[model samples]
Target chain A: MIRRRKIAEALFKLLSLSALALAIGTLVLLFGALMVDGLGRLDWQFLTSFPSRRASQAGILPAMVGSTLVMLVTACVGIPIGVAAGIYLEEYARRTWLTELIEVTVTNLAGVPSIIFGLLALGLFVYTLGLGPSILTAGLTLALLILPVVIVTTREAIRAIPVHIREAAFALGATKWQTVSDHVLPYSAAGILTGVILALSRAIGETAPIVTIGALTFIAFLPPAPVTSQPPYVSFEWLMSPFTVVPIQMFAWVSRPGEDFAANAAAAGLLLVGMTLVMNGLAIYVRYRMRKRVSW
Target chain B: MEIRETVSISHSSVMESASHRRARRRREFLIEGALLLAALVSVAATITILFVLVFESVGFFETVPLLDFLTDTLWTPLFDDPHYGILPLLAGTIVTSVVGLVVAIPVGTVSAVYLSEFASARLREIIKPVLEMLGAVPTVVYGYFALLVVTPALQWIWPELPGFNMLGPGVVIGIMILPLVISLSEDAMRAVPMMLREGSYAMGATRLQTAWRVVVPAATSGIVAAYVLGISRAVGETMVVAIAAGQNPNLTWNPMEPAATITAYIVQVALGDLPHGSIGYQSIFAAGLVLAVMTFAFNIVGHLMRKRFREVY
Candidate 1:
């Protein structure tokens, strides 16, 4: 019985190790497929040049620029709103019916389909508000998409901060705002900021909502300034400028006919993937360092 | 001389100090109100989304009756006053989701079991992070990978199917949501006390036997909840079905044939060529609402089940 038991345990170990190997194998195969299809076509021109009528000459420059502007704007809109909501819920809200309802609604909001948010943007921002199919409209839509994520993370961060800090501030006769600014926000800022970065990275790769908001399939020029003004100031023309993004462009390329288009699509996809990875890596690193600094 | 006017000075200074406190109180009230209002923003956002969907869907129903939209057989919104049948789209979405759930549930739950139950401490550390890495890859990448890789391979064996079809996306979506299913299930499985596994093994049960008969049943609710939530994700998934499944809305059980899910329809119209104020735009929102409702329903179920079934031990 003992000898048989030994053989069975050995078999289980071998099988389990193979299963782990299979998972890694799947990851490698995916990365290999992406590189094989994309790497040879990628070049400096591919990175910096503008889109062209001809398939071979077209580049991701406009798409890349548009993505940056939209992402920055999304972070601008989402982080403040999401983090503030988080702080309010964590620090101020009472354990009442209202707060419990608010919690449930937020969780449900997180589950709402991304496409619906696009529809909301199309109706309210594009049509009703007259934002048009421009960079601002898409950015706002993407911001809403990442709001729940930012809120969730921010709440967790706020919860992690020691209560003693808040007590110390209050004990010193600090007003509520002073306490929050001096102690709460500063203590939790790293974790909350990391969440914002991660959420924006998710937004950057999003295609559905932006496409719905009329992100151009092909843009001849990089995004014009989103807002315009007199001589030296920002102009309104910038706000109205049509834009393209890496994910939207990649979607277009993938659907087209030419075999070459597939390779280009993969190359573009790789760029988007690389950007997302870097953002996520930075977020993780910051989160790690921040947690290390905190003791209890 | 200094003592004579003490009353006047004290009175004025006290009045000024009281006013200053009042102003500070008002400012605090305003900021706190703003914070509460921000939390209320979630409620506003959801209502706005729902209201817009209903508004546009009404616009759609003006062209096509509510009954036809719900009950009709075929979806041909491109043609003249095209039959507004939503069944085919609904069917396609469900079929794909069912396929995804079917594939993801067992494998995800089992692998999760292996990790939480029998794997060494070091192995658990490695496995959890790898699952997270899988979770982070974007959906579009998975969709294209499915189209360029999985579909072609699937076609070689299943010659009866069309060139581009639903199976690839359905299967790939299963792979895509595997991490979610596994992660959630692992959490649930791990919450099962060690005594249960130990007791079963003491009765001379093998590891596999203990996992399947004893531990798994104990954690069934969590496993089931993961399946429910995973199916929701697959159903709401847009890009995979949009690209891999040929943009043809048909009521068919066969996974190999071209069939358009609700999300694929939304993406198709959203891509372009729809007249600005036409039914096309309305249909997109209408479909969006349907997708939203389906996923929301799943989320509620998953959350409730998770809460109710959590094992304290």
Candidate 2:
């Protein structure tokens, strides 16, 4: 019995360790495959030129621009609203049944599938609102998709601020708004920024919602210039212009039946994966620094 | 004279007129109201999602009987003679999710157990972040990896596996959700009090024995919650299945076959220019409504499980 037990213990340990190894091994394999297929194809021209019918000349420029513009809209629309919501919930809202219901709703919203958000945008933004399949619609869809994430993260960051800190501000004759804006917001900025970056990174890779909102798969032209030599020197036409994002572009390439298109997809995937990893790394760094600095 | 001068300066700086006080109070009230409105966005979003899904689905069910939608094995919404049975899509979802859970649960649980009970602190620190990076990697990339890398590799082994079989994407999804399962399960295992482990040790239990017999039992609720959430994630996952699994809706339960999940079907319909409010277009909403309800149920269960675990310890 003792000998069998010893064997079982050793076997279980091996099993567990191998599980971890398997996970890490897969990650390494994924990166390795991406590098092998994509490294040669990824270059400056590939980043700058427009996509072509021929895979050799295809580029991600339009897609990249679209992604940036969409992200701009998402950040502008999502951040202030998300942060304010977080502040209200964390700092101001009284603990009532209504608040509890809201809290539960927010939590559940975070788990709703990204595709459903796409459906919502299609029905609401595209048809009912008559926004068309524009950059603005895609951005709004992604904003709603990331809202729950931002709210949850913001609330967490604010909650990390000790109650005593708020008490100190109150004792100093600070109003509730004053205490929050002056003390809580400043102190939790790093955490909130980290969450926001993480949320945006996640949003950057979303293809389904963008696709569901009917982003054109083959867009060779850029949105109207946001800056021009006109008297006003700025334009809003780009907001209503049809756009395609990186992941959607990647998907279009992947679906094509050719080795060259596959290479293009791999290269695009490399760029996207690299972008998200960097953002995630930055968020981690921010979080680490915040943990080191903020003890109270 | 100096004291009087100081007091006058302090009074002028600190005191405000009644009008000014009222203005400040009103400003605070307005700010609070704005913040409250901002917070309500989430609630509003949830309501909007439900309304859009149900409202559109209502339009769809008006044409297709609810009984046929539930019981029919076919899901050919785009066909000339359309059949809007959701079973095939649901079956594909279930098969892939089952495949994913089959791969994920044991591996994830074991990894979590090892991390919580066996690994050194430094090793744990390195592994944890690496696992988080796995989760952070986008689903679209996973889709690429599944379609290009995994399918070819699986084909080499099986010799007859289709290029877009569910198995490849299912495995990729398993890998995708691995980190979530490990992290959540590890948290639960770690939350199991040290005293229990000490007691097991004192009773002559090996580390593995203690982890398996005592810690695992104690953390069962949390592990269950992790599995529940993983299932929800797998069920809702889009890109991998959409890319690796074929768009044709196959009702078969074979993991080796290509099938379109509900998510994949939605993506398919969206890829085409189906006229707005057309029956085909409305069908995606009905599918989405089904998907949403399934995930929502799983999420609520997961939440309750986590709550129960928290209450226990």
Per-residue alpha-carbon lDDT of candidate 2 for residues A1-296, written as tens digits (9 for 90 to 100): 88998899889878888998999999999999889988889999999989899999999999999999999999999999899999999988999986787798888988998999999999999999999999999999999989998999999999999999999999998889999999999999999999999999999999989989999989899999999897799999999999999999999999888989889999999999899999999999999999899877
Candidate 2 lDDT by residue in tens digits, B1-313:
9999999987886675567778889989999999999988888899999999999999999999999999998998878888889999999999999999999999999899999998999999999889988998888889999999999999999999999899999999999999999999988998989999999999999887899999999999999999999999999999999999999999999999999999999999999999998999999999999999999999999999988888887
- Lowest lDDT block of 10, candidate 2 chain A: A97-106
- lDDT of every predicted structure (CA atoms): 0.82, 0.93
Residue pair clashes in candidate 2: none
TM-score of each: 0.92, 0.97
Local accuracy of candidate 1 as per-residue lDDT tens digits, B191-219 = 88889989998999888778778888988
Q: Supply candidate 2's per-residue lDDT for A80.
A: 91
Worst 10 residues of 1 chain B by lDDT: B128-137
Q: Per-residue alpha-carbon lDDT of model 1 for A35-151, expressed as tens digits?
A: 898877689988887876666787888898888888877888887888888988998899999898878888888877677788899899999999998888988898888989999
Instruction: Note the clash tally of each candidate.
Output: 11, 0
List ranges where model 1 is wrong by over 4 Å.
Answer: A1-23, A226-230, B1-17, B159-161, B198-207, B311-313
* Alpha carbon deviation, residue A4, candidate 1 (Å): 6.8
